[model samples]
Structure formats: structure tokens, C-alpha cells
Target: MLLIEALTTGGAQRQLLNLAVQLGGRGHRVSVVVYHLADYNHRDHFRGEFERAGVPVTDVPVMAPWRRLWAVRRTVRAAGPDVVIAFLRRPGLLAELTALPARRFALIVSERTGKEGGRDMKDLTRFQLHRLADAVVANSAHLEHYVRTAAPWLRTRLRQITNSVDLDHFRPAGAPPPPHPGLRILAIGRFRPEKNFLALAAALRILRTTEPALDVTVDWYGNNFFLGQQPTGRSRPYLELLDVLRETGLEDAFRVHPPVGDVVALYQKADVLCLPSRYESLPNVVCEALACGLPVLASAVSDNDRLVRDGENGFLFDPHEPRSIAEAIRRFAALSADERAAMGRTGRRLAEELLSPATAAVRWADLVEQVVEARRAAW
Candidate 1:
């Protein structure tokens, strides 16, 4: 069984969806449990894909706080999953606290963040409950180190699993839409304060002045609100970016796209993929772009060093400094069209070496079997 807050358009959720489909193909019966979602028609509606794949997905009905635990427990009990794994922190807590008592099923919780991996209250409890989990899955070397430091007693088991990307669907496809004699930049992430789009706007403003003849345009794809409906002016952060663009006379040079079910076409058309997040563990966007044979321009955070070889596949910069971002952009923009295409091809090779979904799913299946056998032997 896989547990998560919601089957929304997020990285962890998408990874689990891909893993579940692959696991099912490997002759495993997979079921999903999600908390706090009212229906399957909302958000990214990833639940529909699971259903279409014939994977049973149960959205535990919303209820009072205390009752929700029981609801999750009841739901898990019904599913009778031998191994209960959760994709994010909140659901991992629930899986550890509840799934252990209901059955001796092996529990695996995934930690997929870098520096901001811990919290004051919830992490304390989670660290204490680490003993109960059969294993901890960290998606990057940075995240794996973070977990080991925070919970040193995890002689239990900490495995670094590169977050999976669908190489088959994400590869370079049809020719990009009518191309102008300029560079196209693509960014994907939430429109939150952490994403630091305002800084990106500043960097783009610099790019406009520094390279007046070069037609550089940015297409950012994401949403601020991921749960369900957007609250009043929830797009304020995205709009503020627009304000920055308009004030700097860059409104025409940038475009913001809402979340989408598929972004392969976006990757195919773009010259490069850019992620300006202030922090990230191992962003799915970077992996997806690399798999799509799109050169990357990303913040120097997490294990991006392993993925991007400076000027080879992409350029990484200090996300905190707009000038730093601009400098990296300048480096990428300096490359000739053939040079940029070569970088993208190199990135695709890296993706195959590191982020292949087939390799990832095999590792997950092997780990599950090992944990399940260990638990069974203990019993």
C-alpha cells in the first residue's frame, strides 16, 4: 500500500504513481491510500490514472483530526498491504504511527528533501518513530545525508533512491513550435515564496538589457495552490512576478502556464529548462527536462551537481542572488545553438544513467522484497 497526503500534481505523488504502475507490471498487487481529498476530479486528478491502470486508490473520507487516524487505520486494515510505504512526511507519520499497530507489515517512509528536511515538532516525532519503520528512502545524496544527521539511530536502514522519471514519455519529441532567432527558457515549480520567481524576474530584466538583440523568453509552468481550489488572490505571488515583469518592461518576454497533465511537449520546444527554486531535494522537473533532452539552467542546490556538469549539461547558480542567476543564464545563452543541443544530449545521457524509471522501479521492488522478507523472518 502507498500512502500520501493527496494524489495531486506533485513530484512525490507522481513518482509513486509511476512506481505503482511499474510494480503492478512486476506482478505485485498495489493499492493507494490518500488522505484529505474529497474527490478525484480536482487538482491534477492523478487518481484517475491509477484507476485507469486498474490500481485501487482509496481516498480516506475527511473527518475530525482524531477520527482521521482511525479512518486511515481502517482503510489500511481493509487493504491488508504487506508493506505500507508513504511518499511524503505527513503520510509517513501516519503510516508509522498507525500502520505498525494494525499489522506487523513492513513500513517504509520516503524522505525527499534537502536542507529543509526537518521540522521542530513533526520531525521530532518522526525521528522517534524511525525505529518502527522498516526502511527510510531518501531521493538524493543530500537528502540521505540530511536524514542520517537528523536521525543517527537509523541503523534501521537508509537507502538513496534517485527520484524516478518516465523516460519513455519525457524524451525529446516533435520539433518545438515555430522558433524565433532567440532562446526559450522554461521553469517549473510552485509559485510560492520559496520558489523565488521575483528574483528570476530581476535576472530576466538583466538579461533583457545585457542581450537586447537576443530574444530570450521565459515560460514558467506551475501553480501556487496544489490542494484543490485556489483561494482569493492565491495567484498573488505569480501576479507579483507579472508586476515585476511589467515594471521592468518584460511582460511580453515572460509567460506563466498553470499545471498540466503532460509537459513533454513543453520540454521538446524549449531551448533549456530552468529551475530557480531557493531550495529543493531532487526536483522532478530537472529530471524530466533532462530526460526530454533539454539542457538545464538550475539553482545550485541539492544533488544537482551530480545531475548537471556545470557547462556540460547545464549551469547551476546561487539561487539567492539574481545576479548569480543572470550570470549562469549568460553562460548558457552564450552557447551556440549546436552547443546547446549537445548539452541537452549530454543531459539525456545523464538521465538514462541516473533517473531511468526502469532502474528506479527495480530498486524499489528489490528493497520492498528485502524489507518484507526481513520482517517475515523476524516473525
Candidate 2:
């Protein structure tokens, strides 16, 4: 697999690492070629893990756009992979541009985002790159629909494969669950405009006023992804969100944490998981939170409606409307502990049925096998 990024901390990064290792263990020669070595917090760690597992690693330093394309072309030439899958848009474009010479290799383009997002490229590079890949992997059925509707030419190649969780690692240990206080809410993800942190803060503010001294604590743990990056408006989003907090006068109630390593424990501590993302294909955090037995309150967009059955396993609200998000929080707050636990139980059940890592690995392996066979047959 030719993944664009090597960082293991981000959602897509971690999934790529997991998929590479899992595929390697199953006797497939998996090689991950990253855009640059300087762009990761856990590079050495992922390198060591891959090395230990016998997975090949290639670091394609980002020189110029054309140079990066040449580097990808050279790497594909050297590795001679049976299948090349590019994650995210820019790299998917690069993979498409370079893989033309290596015509025997099957190219698979994967999109991790759903619909138009706050961080999505303005040029619609994803749509442009669709013609170059043999197949397209959409992380959710909702995302599949969106991509197919947007680019119907590739509808035959589209498939839905939700992000997965390692059941053994994320399952209940029979350890007594932590007792969460009243109105405790948690949201995890990079604090960016795409995540709509401002909307979440505003909703929390409304919840605070509905029941003064609601004892609500929204423990958010994530860093600004664009901090010190070339892209402008990185800090602006956080600043605007902080402005909302100050305006609502609930600045003191919010506990913003700089990104933490283990978020499974965070989900365990919270009564509810709230993801008010402006767009997403399928959020791994939502799946991880559900596996950890936390009911979700996510925006009614993309696969959220499919994953979160309103008032059943969890609730879905309009991401753009603070009132809708606030009302969902209020409803969750009104539920008894047993009722909340029941909701969480239903989410966990759904996760077990659909989002286990073993299940996802098997599905991906099957796809890889098919691609490999097709390549061999053509040869």
C-alpha cells in the first residue's frame, strides 16, 4: 500500500499503519511510502513496528510537486507492488500521475473524508483522481453514496468498508466502569474548523443555561492540526472557538487538553461522545468510542445517521445548528444512568456486529487478494 502520510497519530495515519501491519502478518508484502519524514509525531515508532513485522518502508521526501511525483514513480518502480492504494487527495493525485507508467499495478484510491469538508481541497482533486484508480474505497455507505453521486463514472468500483476497532484491545475488561458525573460530555478530534468545535462549544453553552450548575464538563483532547503550518486559519479556528466560549461565558467550564495518547480511556470516562464534524466519511473515533461502550451524539451527516439511530443507539443533530446539538445534549442529560447505559449497550452491540478490526482486516485482505490475482492474470 502506498499511503501518503506516515504519521501514526492521526485517524487515517493510524488506520494505514494498522492495515499495513495486519496485511504484512498475513504473508502479503506491504510497503508504505510516505510523503515526507518530517511530518509525523510517531515516525520512529511506526518505523520500528513495521520493521519488526517485516513490512518495508520508504520515505519519499516532499521536494517539489513534480519531484514528489517522480519520487512516487520511482518508488512504485522499485517496489513493483501488485496493488497501490493512495490515502487522501493530494497523494491520490500524485499516485494517479505516477502510476500510469506502472500500468500492471492495480491502483486503489481511498477517501477518508465525506462530502465537502472544512479542510477539503477547493479544486476537488479527489474527483479528478477518481479516473486513475481501478477501485475506490469509501469508508462508509453514506460516503459511497456521496462519491458515486458526485462522480458517477466510477460507481462500479465504489465500495463501503467502515473503519475498524481491535475488539480485544478496546473491549470491556469487566473492570468496573468509571462513574461519570451528570451532564459529562466528551468530543475528540483535532480542534479544527472542520470538526466544528465552535458549534460544539456553543451547544454546550446552551446546555449550561438550561440547567445552571449542570456540572457539565466537556473534556476535549486534541491539538490544532494546522498549528505553525503553511496553511493559514489554523489558529483562527481555535481563536474563534475560544471567542465562542468567552461569549457564552462558559470559558471556565471547558477543559481543553493537548492531544493525549490513549483516547479509549477518555471515552470510558465520559457519559456521551459528541462528534459535531462538518463532514466525514466515517470517523474512527466514533467507532472506537462505541466499542468502548459510549453512546454518541454526532451530527446528522454522512454515515452518522447510519451509525447512530436517533434516540436508539445514540442521537444525531444538525452540525451547523447549535440549537439542534444543544437539544441532543439536553436530552442525553435527562436520561437516567440506566437509560444512558442501555443506549451505550446498543452502540456497543452495533459496533461488534459491524466494526471489529478482525472483520475489517479480512475484508481488506480479500480485496487485496483479488487485486493481486487480477494483476497476476494480466501478466
Model 1 Cα lDDT, one tens digit per residue, 1-379:
9898887767787788888998898999999888983432235458778888898877777677678888998888776678998988778878887855546688898887555435567666777887778899999988888778878888459998888887888897655456567778998877777788888888988877887776788888776552345433555776677778778888787888777777788888888888888788888889999999999988888888888899899999999999999888888888887898899889999998998778888899999999999888888
> What C-alpha lDDT do the candidate models reach, one value each?
0.82, 0.75
Task: State TM-scores per candidate.
Answer: 0.91, 0.88
Query: What stretches of model 2 exceed 4 Å from their correct place?
Result: 37-56, 117-125, 178-180, 226-233
Residue 127, candidate 1: alpha-carbon lDDT:
75
- Scanning candidate 2 in windows of ten residues, the lowest lDDT window is 37-46
In model 2, the clashing pairs are: 114-280, 114-281
Candidate 1 structure lDDT? 0.82
Model 2, 156-260: lDDT tens digits are 878777788776667543654667566778888776678988888877777767877567778787765442443234456766777777777877777676666
Give the C-alpha miss distance for residue 322 in model 2, angstroms: 0.6
Top-lDDT structure, candidate number: 1
